[model samples]
Target chain A: MSDIEIKDNPDIKSELQTPPEPGYSEWRKDENTLYNDGLPEEEKDWFCDARPQKARKSVQVIENFLNWARSQSLWILAFGTGCGAIELRPLVTSRYDISRLGMQPRPTPRQANLIMIGGYVSIKTLKRIVRSYEQMQGPKFVVAVCSCAINGGMYWDSYNTVKRIDEYIPVDVYVTGCMPRPEAVLAGFNKLKELIKAGKAEGQNLYIERFDWYKENQKKVIKDWNMPDYNW
Target chain B: METLYKELKQYFDVDEFSVQKASLAFLRVPKSQLVSLLTHMKDIRGYTHLVMVTCVDYLEQDSFLLTYLLHNYSTHCDLGIQVSISRQNPVMDGIHHLWEQGRVYQRELFEMFGIDFPGSPDVHEPMILEGWQGPPPMRRDFDTKAYSEATYSHRPRDHKEPEEYMKQQLYPED
Candidate 1:
């Protein structure tokens, strides 16, 4: 007898072809009311609770040019989560000199376009990673380094460590190793550049589209989820 | 160290005097006499530094062996005071009053072993495993492998044994 059931039935489908409400969709939200319910009342004002919106891609020619530019100047947020962070240090030194690839370390997440998830992500660190990933502007990329990030590596059976990082946040590229060498990380950067130039690296947008699924997975592991639903 | 132990034995109920080296020794003290012994060593004897507080779970014995390793900076000697407490009770007298660093160690013991240090500050609060619902993980009975498998989802494993895989790669014809 419900509206959904009526629409599904072939006999009643012809009689009630049109929906009761004109252009009314369950997915649409009232912009003012849809605030992050997770935060305390006093702290709610500190953060923007508006859901993440997908970035509109520009016309093909201009978008391609912009993607090329974005790929060239990849500013990575300097956040080290685990032991794999050791591999990242060598990239800046004279031996590797990652600056030549147009990638440089940025102090804050807001200013950076890329976040390298260096090694295993414990539930505790995953909370911070989610917050930082959310804070970064759209078209942002994640380069998860180490076999630990790829699967779980040595911590596959660990009670504290996360098995797959992608369940919480969308990962664009995975550089595999126990702790991938600096050379392998550079190769990963090159792969990311190729993805960017081809307009394939849309992890930020994919995250927004599958926001609910990611949040559910994140909330399961992170028991003390006291922060706002979206840290924005 | 033997002279020091002999002198202390007359005053306090100390047993099992073990000499690890010329500079290191260990002795067992009853639970009730632990605080007094540590105080006597610190004030009367020259063992002024409290090196560390550690616990070992004896599952078969149903007891937890708590060790308070103390050091004498002047003599360059280490004395470890061992006290065995019941697994059922799992309570210890807080030595936070004697050494401030003992408070942190007590807090860690409380978190890892479910041991209670009633008077110690923030002893009940979680140290590392925040909002952990299960029993104390460091307990011998707590099956970590089972807990991990139940809690976290795993990828379908396509892994082969290293020796066999290496042989296949090196000698494909065979």
Candidate 2:
């Protein structure tokens, strides 16, 4: 009976328990293989397949000066992932004008140094967020706004919404509120500025360091990962 | 509404006709005659606007009740046509020809309720819940809470009753 059962099972448990196939980190060093297996053969050439590298730090005096300058003139990418975007709108308005702190909304990620991930991130929206976050230049900082981005807030039990924003991307500062007022966002920005000036906010480098972990977490939820491993 | 219902009854095998208000009424029709009745109402009775196409899962009854709400712009009257389809084999006639927007609704129904509308364009394609692998979420049999728990990892909750928390905050000394 034991022999019959062993023959019938066919090692199903071992098959199910096998580790997932090697991700980007394992084969990223290889020059010949494609970075984007999801994309069609024709379109693969359009995207850059190069792996991200850590940005080098300059001399102490220059680095401090650069950090100070970067902190003062925070060019924020105006990408709203959820409802917290409504609060962000008021920051640009006359009442809560964010320009007073040298922070302004930049239309594109290429020019922006700061990104505010506003509110709950659904699976579909997380894909876009990851893409945008990757597109941003080095020395970039992330300011996760609202309770939703911090820990899923009201969408805690939601099937599609991602709970912690940090699992996907490194967050420099967190502003906790259920749709935080513009005042709280400004405060969060102030905290981010402090971190930047103190030379503590290095989320961009942290992302590159733990790229594999982030990618695995992202791929777990985003089933249809049709884009490149790295968006660049 | 009574007059319209009586008139519709004469042409189609419509049953369970009830007027909820002066301007709104609901009636159930056989699945086969749904398209014809909708076309008749649109062309003849002036209920031209297709407001929405929604479904209610009757898990106990082993059926799905589909509602096709139509609005008449001129008279400001809303008419809902209901069709009960079997749960085991949920399929419905596509009314995209009568109303172009019906295709979008049909697509939504297909994704949510797993109801197939054979002729509707892009009905099989996912409208929302992209790349979803589990059973149709909107079906009554699909346990959403269980699915959520199984699929998503939750934070360890330190929950306190709102009333108790509030009272504790306000009267800590007590």
Candidate 3:
């Protein structure tokens, strides 16, 4: 094609490079979304009226020491969905053997208490992750171990990948690196243990409390969700 | 190679045929004559191995060029058959009966290109990318970069030369 031909041709510029369709904005106008759009009239006032009951303080029990013990021995199910998976192999081996710290990789989500989201969690994988997160029993902690889990690292601009794992499930510790070393992963586990000891890592309870919000976010992206609202 | 090309040309009015360096040859066949030609190549020409089934997008022509690559194990020769179909409505004859493994590649092509193989069983099932809502992403018209921008939110970054930043960190004098 000649210079003038190139200048005049609209095909040179892709439809995507151009702005959205002209009537899209006009059609979307006058449409306001309310919080209780689908809810019954009786349940419309529920959100504003709902208030969490204050926790009653109690004396520490002898069984409460299990929290400290549990912190020391964290069973992790590495959801290695991206490049950060390579770093975790060494964590089990001698060089940066995190298994020595009692941080072991478990196969089943049911048997595991801690979940380490290794790098990018795409929209499809996010559903399974949420189900796995919900399957674990109470007193569970999450350590999001990679930059992708934090804010989508390499796939930050990809449509399918989720930006932040924390938005979907409660993340106790965030190990920041494009692909964090096994040493950094150990540090993150150690940090999570510290939070557990201090009684601050209550991600499980938080997840339960904000279940609706998380489910809304999850269902919005994952079309054709045939599973139950909550796995539990 | 000349005998093979001439035989194909004599039987069917092939659009284009060229013998590449070595025992490799390329043939552009119309979609209508694809199955019969492939069957003839496999049965008579001794090109038994159905190597792979793949497609290329011809954006300028507004069509998809589906290629079936075959190999002859005995002679160690390769033959590629190229067939172009409409981009808007891409439906092609399934060569799965010739080679059972062709079904797998056909399924993938269908998943990525939105092409349909009428006789293939795996065409309707899910492939690598499951529950895909967007257009056939491999198409030239499907702008993935734009899709990424629209679907995903990117952080505004203040980028600096990593070398200069490392120089300051390692050698403060520099």
Candidate 4:
């Protein structure tokens, strides 16, 4: 009975070969690798025609909407990644009253329009920052607080702290100091507000549409298994 | 105009002492007299606050730039005294003996940048990380990305499987 059971077992396979599927290669091409002939003759007329006028009109509307939207709100993601966070507290606290200028810090990236990457962002924290930036809705901005975030003020040589956050994420404002003064941090905040008011704060989606660099960098900064809770 | 600067200049024969337009003064003193210089700054200069003591790692130039950002509530001016030291085996005396706040900044500079501050009460224990074993993590050579991957625990990131969605659309599950 044991010998018969062993011979009858279906788990073992004598040979293995990859299955073949027709039109597999035909469908596998990325946007850039298309073959004109491979497309159906009937549908060929419907494909690849440049709509310059329609494209222009849509661009104009989006440009107008974005310009108007940028002025109304400029949310800051309070990263508070290091000791520089100390100064930021007073800005938001009762003394400085940062909210007077219609500015308040948001904890979650999803709700933030700007990311204040306070102090030196270590590579470990950078991964989280990148993920946060991604989860945030469109029209985002970043501020590198302190000289450390710009070029690693004192921790430049340390293995853990990144010299510049710009290498990992695009920064719209840079406040310089070992840990920048409260006034300097306020200056950066004001600069962000001015940029937003000027209708200059463009969203990352513009770059994401033009080039694949953002997408490639997004993957490189964060490992495939490390990320969770991303928003649509 | 601060008495501490005047006193130190007389006693130490500092190389240069020039006050910038911003009301901040830059005092350049001999490296040997730094300890004495710090002592007088705290005692007589009215520079009571030790804002931060940090080092800039300039590997290409082979120097560690030490900056002491000091503020005097009495005088109401912020002064940043910057000094460059040799990168290899850097050492300096702890000024914790002078300003009480220097203790934390000095120890922080030591742990974060590995600049040895002798007489510091606690310089070896990790402040930002646990069980760190390697060159000072802030040095230009230290790869932060690699260290982060090896050290810290990360949360999961969401990613959609677009191809899988397309396949599911064409072929329904049983």
Displacement of residue A56 (Cα, Å) in model 4 is 11
**Can you list each candidate's DockQ?**
0.25, 0.29, 0.19, 0.04
Instruction: Compute the lDDT of residue A54 as modeled in candidate 4.
Output: 10
A-chain TM-score, model 1: 0.85
Candidate 1 lDDT at B148 equals 78
Q: Write the per-residue lDDT of candidate 2 for residues A185-227, one digit (tens) a residue.
A: 9999999988988999998887877666677777878887789
Pairs of colliding residues, candidate 1: none
Off by over 4 Å in 3: A1-64, B1-3, B15-25, B154-174
lDDT of 1 by residue, B57-169 (tens): 99999999999999999999999999999999999999999999999999999989999998999998877877678899889999877887688766544466566688899
- Runs in model 4 deviating more than 4 A are A1-69, A206-225, A228-232, B1-174
CA-based DockQ, model 2? 0.29
Relative to the real complex, the DockQ score for model 4 comes to 0.04
- Write model 1 residue lDDT over A1-232, tens digit each, in one string: 1331111234222322332332312322453333455568898788766777778999999999999999999999856888889999999999999999888999899999999899888888898999999899869999998888877889877878887888788889999988788999999999999999999999988887666667777788888777877777
* Model 4 per-residue lDDT at B44: 77
Model 3 residue A101 CA deviation in Å:
1.0
lDDT of 2 by residue, B69-145 (tens): 99999999999999999999998889999999999999999888999999899888866677788888888778776
User: Chain A TM-scores, all candidates?
Assistant: 0.85, 0.86, 0.73, 0.65
User: Total backbone clashes of model 3?
Assistant: 0
> Candidate 4 lDDT (Cα, whole model)?
0.64
Interface RMSD of each: 11.3, 10.0, 9.1, 16.3
